[model samples]
Target: MQENLPRKAACIGGGVIGAGWVARLLLAGVDVSVFDPAPDAERVVREVLANAEHATARLISAPLPPQGTLSFASSIEAAVEGADFIQESVPERLDLKRRILGAIDAAAPADALIGSSTSGLLPTDLQAEMSHPGRLFVAHPFNPVYLLPLVELVAGGRTAPESMERAVALYGAIGMKPVVIRREIEAFVGDRLLEALWREALWLVNDDVATTEEIDDIIRYSFGLRWAQMGLFETYRIAGGEPGMRHFLAQFGPALKWPWTKLMDVPDLDDAFIEKIASQSDEQAQGRGVRTLERIRDDNLVGIIRALAAEQGGKGWGAGALLREHEARLRAAAEPAPAGEPLRLMEGEVDAAWIDYNGHMTESRYLQVFGETTDALLARIGAGADYVAGGRSFYTVETHIRHLSETKQGEAFHTTTQILGTDAKRIRVMHRFHGGDGTLRATAEQMLLHVDMGAGRASRATPEVLEAIAAIAGPQRALPIPPEAGRGISDLR
Candidate 1:
């Protein structure tokens, strides 16, 4: 997980994988230049990017970086020109890939890192024609690339060790889990695993043992769920009971020698067999187009990732951990308050979960936002996680909130905080909540006591904290206090 993003990137092809690369790069705030000769290249990229944006917005809660600019160049040279990073996602033909990579190497800067989106081709072969072969490496990613976080980074004979290091940082910075392959091999790890299962699946269908739908259901309902979280060996370890993995493996390992799978053979894809598979696949779809099915896949992926992120006391599990870490990075990378403005530290849309039966933003969420705003203020005054870890922090003692407007689900909103006053032992603050259109929606005023966690009582804050508080308090004192600052429920009536 790195925080530094590539300043500029180039996509050598704009097909599904190429467009996916563009979406991920642009969302991470890197300017992208793409080149694809297909007549529908721009349209394809736009549609894919739109889907990426929609799915990503629902997947994360942290403030996203402003989207970077996207451009399509007429030639490979034009696309790679001055790019700090370049990804080649052209069709899987060796000659085509070699030519494209060679052209990119000729045009891109000497220090630029180049990655190939080849699924099975060897990186050594792909970089054969390149003038700067040391910069090229395989960066294989799964389909719907913007959502899937796994990207295998495989180095070739000529690839520099530093190139692998840079590849991990660049891809990890964009929220990807870059697993470096220890040795270069065709199809790599993930695809090789899939190929074995796929071979067996074809045999099952060819022999009329099961329909495609049944095969899919079996995996999705059983090991698929397990693999999504715990993975294979860990999932099997649970099956071992009190004895653990050794017992499980001893019982099942010998079964691997049984003639239960056709892993060594592939079903003949003759005309009839092809039609049988296609017809069954069509029946499984039941009439959904490619894009509809794509959205469905994206939505399901988002749900799983988010659920994983919420597991283990919110530290996240598996891919969810990656999402959580990425969210933290995004929050930390958020631009600070412009010099004189009230600290605009938090803003987000009303999530569906935040809505009430009345179809409006619920009251609890109002307090939640205010609570988060106070957290932001505390962090500004040098009382963040580390400060609290040292056994002291500000504790909110009283709060008064007045909701003046109704906000429905999906309505964008922001909050601004001002320090009304502060002392060695106490602080007073107010937060104004507004809609995206700048309409004031609500107000909250809070009083906090600086406390020593070890003592569980009021205590003077550190001199450094007091100085930080004074700096903001001194400037905010000139602004008139909000009318609802200290009001009670009766005063509103």
Candidate 2:
């Protein structure tokens, strides 16, 4: 994964996929320009970003990294100029892709990488009309880009090997696993495999062997669980046990020639099949809207990723490299102390899982509470994902917490943050936690350092952030450090 690199990117075609690409790129701190002829492109992009921000904030265990500025271009030429990378997410029509590439090639610099979000089209076919086809390739990402980490990178006939490498590096830097397709091929690897399974699934439903929902259940309840941590080959390897690879293949190979599927034949989009699938899917979805479903999906994905990551180790455990990149990003976005009055109040809750055997909140859960409280204060002071993407960040350097009243599970809590002091490189903050009854439950004091994410070290805060802190601090109350917290801070110091 690339670390602390900044690049300007342009997204061509502001549809669902295009907007998803914009959200992911901007959240990763890349300055993005978007262009689409649709009248509502700007509004659509804004809504997509908003949804992404909510999902991202909840999905991540750590605080989200800074986000980049978003700009809209009236023309394709204006969007591609000076961009380090261009993501093409226009309509799937081959002619439309050809025209867009032609325009981008004419405007963008020779060295800039251009990637298509095409699902099944060959990159070579898409780049046929480009003047500099070597710079063009496929960067197919799954839906809801902010949640899914997989990005398939495919190099076309004229695409340079270096371009592919750069693309991998670029996507990897942003916490995505960029699997490279060695040669130009239709549908690429993941999609082709999915298509194969989808064909069999359709046949099963069409032949009354199973209903659509039943087929889905079979995959989700069985293979999906195994696929989450270990992929197909590895899962089968484990299943074979002492028999090993050859023995495993021998057992399964015989079933391949059976009349199990019509893999070569395309299912006719007949009215009956379409209606059956549509009604079943709609029934399964129920009355929930698209946004609601998207949120649920994103939350599930986050839970799975977190479980995998934690199981592996502290960092890079399950997903390894990609998860590490995400950790680095979170570390870069920790809270910093504000200036002036410094005290800010924010509300939160003690999660049910944070309770221990006694049914009260555990000791470590207090730290998490204070941590979230600090995040809220920072977010209020404009220290959010967008802030970090601009090459500025905050890191916690010191912390002190005092336990007072023991809070039980399901109790609501509130935190008040106070800025103690500030300098060019560091700021001090104090927090007090109150239980549902407004009784002080705990107190915490911390010191944070401004950081330059690119340099991977302490650095001075930008004037904008400093000024925001100053504004918030000006009218706030003094740091009312509780007596217990004062002693705790003294001991820690």
Candidate 3:
């Protein structure tokens, strides 16, 4: 994780999953170039990227790394020309996969690891037409790739052991848990479990035993809650009390003989059945739409990942080493504004909901804007989880804000922060908000106290941190407080 790896990668296919791979890779600070025959791929990628930013900012406890630049290419060869790794996210058809893999193999470097985002397609089948089959493997990721962390890494019969190891290392570097499938299997791992659950759900719905929403409730409220912290076997073991796994299995084994699952049978995807499922699914989704659902899913994922990481030691310190590396990149990208820069500009656009009744920006949204900027600055100064874990943090003690002008909807703004002054225990900062047109919108001044997180009290800044701040603070001095900010104060005495 300490080593800096190549930050550029290419994604072949700009379909739903391919776009997701692009979003995740870009968020992880890897420059991603996408190739797809679809029209308006660039616009599609931008919209996805924008949505990804909002989801990530809300879901992640730590700051996100600066997103990598996204470029679009007309062909597969152009995209993988200089990429360190290649993610093939094309159609599920075996012929399409083989054709794309062959093209990628011909284009990419001999040593570069190529991953397929196929659900259950065997890597051997996909790589049959590849010139260097050893470099290709299945790297199946769950849907909504930006949020989910699990990646099933399967090596085909032609996939060399060294290629599998290299793929693991590369995926690990980007912060994903790459589980190596001992042998290539259909549906990999997660999908197999999901498909099993889907079958029972479909049977229930088809037989009129339950509605789609009701089935969702059953999983989300019952088994899903238990599955979050402790997985199935462990949870079942606990359910057995002190009896252990053997007893638990023996008790449940009898039920296995019953017709509880359709594991061996496949569902008919005939038109009527498809329509019934789709209509019911649409009803269950309630027209909130894909973007809305994706946001909710990503937020839930963030909460789950954070909870798991916290429980397993901050940042899941060991379970997934690659995730830690990704977290580190995020922390670096979200670093706060340096002191004395009158304005600390952040690079994110306003979401639609932030607009007010007048179609102008809301005051509260302004505060959120400033707050996020401040958080980014603090992260920059190393006042984050890792710093807090090491027992040091900065706490805001006071703030004064003055609104000057109106900001309309969809307008981009920047917050500039200045380091006022610092003493042994306290530091002062001033912030100003400016619209993209360079109009001043508001200003804020604040005081922060350094604290020993373990002791819960004020503390002196560490020399290393102080030096970093000093470097960013530069030589500009804080300006005098304006009269508007002092109006309601009792300090007149």
**Which numbered prediction scores highest in lDDT against the true structure?**
1
lDDT of 3 by residue, 1-493 (tens): 4133355789998877888889888877789989988886677667667777766654443444666888888788889988878999988999888888899999997777899999999988888898899888999997777766679999898888988888777766566777998877888888888888888888877777987888999999999978766768888989777988888888888999997777777667789878888888898888897767876776566556545654443445333233444655655644544444454445444445667888777888777666656655666666656787798888888877777888775566666767767775776776778787878888777788999978888989888778766766655555555444433445656
Give the alpha-carbon lDDT of every model.
Answer: 0.88, 0.76, 0.74
Q: What is the lDDT of residue 115 in candidate 3?
A: 93
C-alpha lDDT (0 to 100) for residue 274 of candidate 3: 83
Best by TM-score: 1
| Candidate 2 lDDT | 0.76
Cα displacement (Å) at residue 370, model 3: 5.3
Per-residue lDDT of 135-185 in model 1, one digit per residue for the tens?
999999998899999999999999999999999999999999999999999
**Each model's TM-score?**
0.86, 0.72, 0.74
Which stretches in model 2 have alpha-carbon errors above 4 Å?
Answer: 1-6, 315-317, 329-493
Q: 390, model 3: CA deviation in Å?
A: 3.7
